[model samples]
Target: MHRSPTAEAEVAEELAEARPDLVSRYAAELPGARAAVLTRLWRALAYEPLPWVAARVTDGDGLSLRLVDGRRLDGPPADPYATAAYVTDVRLDGRTYDDPARLMTDLGVPHSSDLAAELGHSVASLALSRAGQPTVPPKEGPGADWEWEQRVVDGHPFHPNCRSRPGFSVTEQLAYGPEHRPLVGLRTVPVPAAECLVSGGWPEGMRDGERLLIPVHPWQAAHVLKRVGDEGPVAHPLMSLRTLALSGEGPHVKTALSARLTSSVRDISVYSIGVSATLSAFAESLASRTDGLLHFTRTLGAVTADSPDLAAVLRESPQTYAGSGERVVPVAALATTDLPSSAAWLAEFTRLALTVGLRLLDLGVALEAHGQNLLVVLSATGAPLRLVYRD
Candidate 1:
């Protein structure tokens, strides 16, 4: 059931009494939050390959889909790739459903209740992101590479949990969400050298008195690792919130963040820790055959407390490829910026991405070359220079 505006204010007031800080934020976030939920629900209805969607077609004004129960659903034209907002309500069998959660409940689909809760959280998170000042990078101005990555205010293009952060609090999201552009103070834990399984080369600076100091994400340190020591290094959070650029240079530290962000909970697997170095070396060898168009960020080091919940991987930042006056932008964020929407530029970027992706596949590695994992090194004038692939 959708909460009325008065009901929403009452709830906010109740929360504000305990938090105090939430009073202003709650009011500021509500409108954006509702719109986010509507967008997510619309995405799920339009796409998602649901069994209930018997057939789908498009018309002049919008889209039309037939349900298994012979109910007709209609809405505005859906552009899954575009981040622009869409109408919040859709007509279901000539009846309008104002909220997506209510629509799902009426549809009686499996896992409807659970999904409704997740959708609610997604709305709240999106509202928080939209309420804050968006961090956009200048077209050709001097800015850190991370700043460009952080400019992706919208979360995912198609998934319903685009901005869903189920386990993160509002304060945590403001401090660590990549869109917030927060410089996180990473803490390190001293694990006995023999007790830790390591891959690749651990930095000498991470060692102290016969112990290997393993970096932990602050969130993980508080909720998962729970053995945080001194504040080790300051880092900027990347598009992937789990990974942080050590001062936007050198290597990125991917720490375990045990929460449902976007679609799923991301944690460093024990298996990945075991083979990080080998995989990095293998990827490097394959990248050499791409004729310098591809650069695989090497896994500099990986350490685990013999637990998937407590792990860290030090990865080379993709910024290494960009020379002076060149810019490295994540493909997802690039879509948000003005990158000269010319046929030549699009064709060039497509060719470069496909060439590198296919080359690696021929060499026995299939890259998950989605927008998030794929990046482009662009010339000052927006010419596609090279491709950077990361997991």
Candidate 2:
């Protein structure tokens, strides 16, 4: 039996036709990308509470997993936080497997095939993302905050499906992916005010008389909505692909994108829209007790056409919290800078983050301080200053 083409092969075929110039570069990036994804998968197997992983054994040879099916999966010791592509391959039942998708397929666990497909896409898309990055890392900080977001080419550091944009074609990935740094033109769907549930103050620029102009992601407009409106703001895509940063220090616009990205389909539900204002106010009040150590970007507005498929949320940019000579950077983009390598700096950042986090928790609030939602304000000397959290 002949096996189907892997996602990398499929992407290569697409690039060969649409952009032959990128074919060689994409191919060159595959080995590193594969190892990067394999490292994440190994981490998951070593630590995640998966039912099939019967037991974990560690010996002088490194880490080993005994599956419920009585097969052994072996690899190097997993470091959950390490970003380097240290994992080249792993042994599954005496057979060596380099590709994560292939290894998962041969493992033959329940739902492994579905995971295998996503892993394939993840490797391919990750390579494509790497191929588009600049050859040398930037020596200085970016002119705008959104540029720091684009620097995170590898997406989620721990997820195996970090770059698995299943519905996005190579062309679409290049055109819309934040790593590619494309200018995405947003569209606004007109919905009558009476038919919409709105919270906070909707921008007058987005109001069409009595109708609310809902911002829509181009991908969502084409694939889900099946209707496009007149050209709206041409903005920079942020770390969260559904959200975009408007030009010249404007708010970040979050659109309802109904496609599965990594784990879930990102769509603004009516319940969330209805509670936006209350939640924002509550979060703000909680943040106020932090005494200048923490900040929450306010949700400027939220609206929905009574459907998850058509909703929008406008929020103030986290950069708004940055004073002159300071930089507010998403935690995910910290790898692009040398700050993380400094033990002293990391300690300071840890203390500040824990201080705010513990303070909030003591006051009856637990923040989602994940890489994407959390940011650090760095002084002109690159010292950690404070923390910023947003959804």
Clashing pairs in 1: none
- Tens-digit lDDT track of model 2 for 1-391: 1122579999999888877888999999998888999999999899999999999999988899999989999999878778788888899888888899998899888999999999999999999999888788778679899999999999998899999999999999998999999999998889899999999999899989999899999899999999987688989999989999998879999999898898789998999999999999998988888889999999999999999999999999999999999999999999888888999998999999999988888888788798999999999999989988998
TM-score of 1: 0.88
The superposed Cα distance between candidate 1 and the true structure at residue 10, in angstroms, equals: 9.9
As for candidate 2, its clashing pairs are none
Compute each candidate's TM-score over C-alphas.
0.88, 0.97
Residue by residue across 1-391, what tens digits does model 1's lDDT show?
Answer: 2443333443454455544655676677766666666766787678889998899899998989888888888988877765555666778888876565566666777888777666666666665666565345355543877877788877776666777777676667878988878889999988898999999889998999779988888888888766666787999888889888888356888988888787678888888899999988888888889899998888889999898887899887888888999988889887766564777788888888888878777878788887788889989888999998886
Q: CA shift at 172, candidate 2, in angstroms?
A: 0.6
Q: Provide the global lDDT of candidate 2 against the true structure.
A: 0.90
lDDT of 2 at 116: 93
Clashes of 2: 0
Residue 129's lDDT within candidate 2 is 93
Task: Name the TM-score of candidate 2.
Answer: 0.97
